[model samples]
Target: MAMKAIDPQYTADTKYALEVRNVDIYYSAFRAVKNCSFGMERNKITALIGPSGCGKSTVLRSLNRMNDLIAGARTEGEVLYRGQNLYDPDIDAVQVRRSIGMVFQKANPFPKSIYDNIAYGPRVNGWKGSKAEMDELVERALRGAVLWDEVKDDLKKSGLAISGGQQQRLCIARALAVEPEVILMDEPCSALDPISTLKIEELMFELRQRYSIVIVTHNMQQAARASDNTVFFLMDKEDRAGQIVEYGPTEQIFQSPKDERTEQYISGRFG
Candidate 1:
């Protein structure tokens, strides 16, 4: 099927930290997401919320070319990071991921020590520093994710040995270790308990002071509470391809959405 979007002409101004411009994602001939577009502001959180299989995660992964890791998966249109199209052939996907880091729905820590998990990215990215500098970096990252106090004495412990919530925070700290300009989270709290979820949300609030964040979440209340902007997606029944249906401030989206579909979904009328 030909690709299309509910808001096909969407654009972002210079103030945006990153922007998806009429992007379509596909695996082979199967289009997973239609021309979805939205902007993420610097030092702010933008949440992508929708029902299952609406391509919320697909779109989030596209920001850093994570989709490229899938066989035959490709993206169409522009994904601008610092004014450069990330899909361009000259762009390095590795560097893209390094700059725009990601945390998955599940906590996937490396089978290494907590300190090593945090050091891995920087090492791969050619970070050359003394032991003290590397140690400081690790401490800063753990503290940034709010995991230092709990795991400070356990830096030598295996990342997998930590609690699920702590493991997720460790994954987050791993992302921050490289000092990414933007963080893409695919339901970072979905696997955690309520308390853990709240901690992640609060950490997001604090992290936004230094990094731009884009989160794909199914939780409507979480989106309303944690994000400055929200984009609602819906699948086109005919094509089974997802598209952005509404995009605006979180308050407007929750209180007075311009689209009735957004209202119905958020109000628990239908997914």
Candidate 2:
């Protein structure tokens, strides 16, 4: 299939809140991502679509430097956040992760209480507010995730005690409490039921006014329904590496994608 994102001169706007430029990733000697690039508009949701192992999740993890946790995983090229390249030697990956938070496919919360889960980031970063202030922030975060009413009475309950969907929302609340400028989610709704997925989708809409969101999903309908833009990924010739094939407005990409691979993937013919 024709790869539409290959034009090397195609530079996305820095006015965008986030930018991925010719990014390549590797695990030890094996390359897993090859020259993927895209730009994300401020406070908008951008969906990454591809088959499993097509580097969608890898790209998402690279954004906040999660891949760095692995001993042999390394990335080539730079991820620019608000004009600054995140991979620069001078940049602190920790700060980068804080500015851009992440959510995973499975809902994973600490064994700690719900209150502690929401307060974890802020506390670690030194949030020294009065009890009333912390309480308000926690409530706001829970409400933002649309979980306050259900768990408000049980703030002391372990976050793991909640249902899968509720736990996912709680994870979202924890990410929000840090007041990040960008949030990355990897297949967040894959394990959720229809009702719960709708809530998360609705939450994405509500969040766009304040936070830039990037999501990786195999769900074409969810990507088309929830995101303003989409990036379609594909495997390299050897099938050992993945790369972006196309990126554009969601309507354009889904309805009239410039790349044949994108069309095939979105139309359920392939992924």
| Highest-scoring model, lDDT | 1
Model 2 misplacement above 4 A: 1-13
Worst 10 residues of 2 by lDDT: 1-10
Give TM-scores for every candidate, taking all chains together and pairing residue i with residue i: 0.94, 0.93
* Prediction 2 global C-alpha lDDT: 0.90
* Candidate 1 lDDT by residue in tens digits, 3-64: 22222244446878888999999989999999888888889999999999999999999999
lDDT, candidate 2, residue 199?
Answer: 90
Candidate 2 lDDT, 1-271, residue by residue in tens: 3322222243456558789999999999988999988998898999998988888898999999999999999999989876678887667677888889999999999999999999999999888999999999999999999999999999999999989999999999999999988999999999999999999999999999999999998788999999999988888877579988889999999999998888888889975
Point to the candidate with the largest TM-score: 1
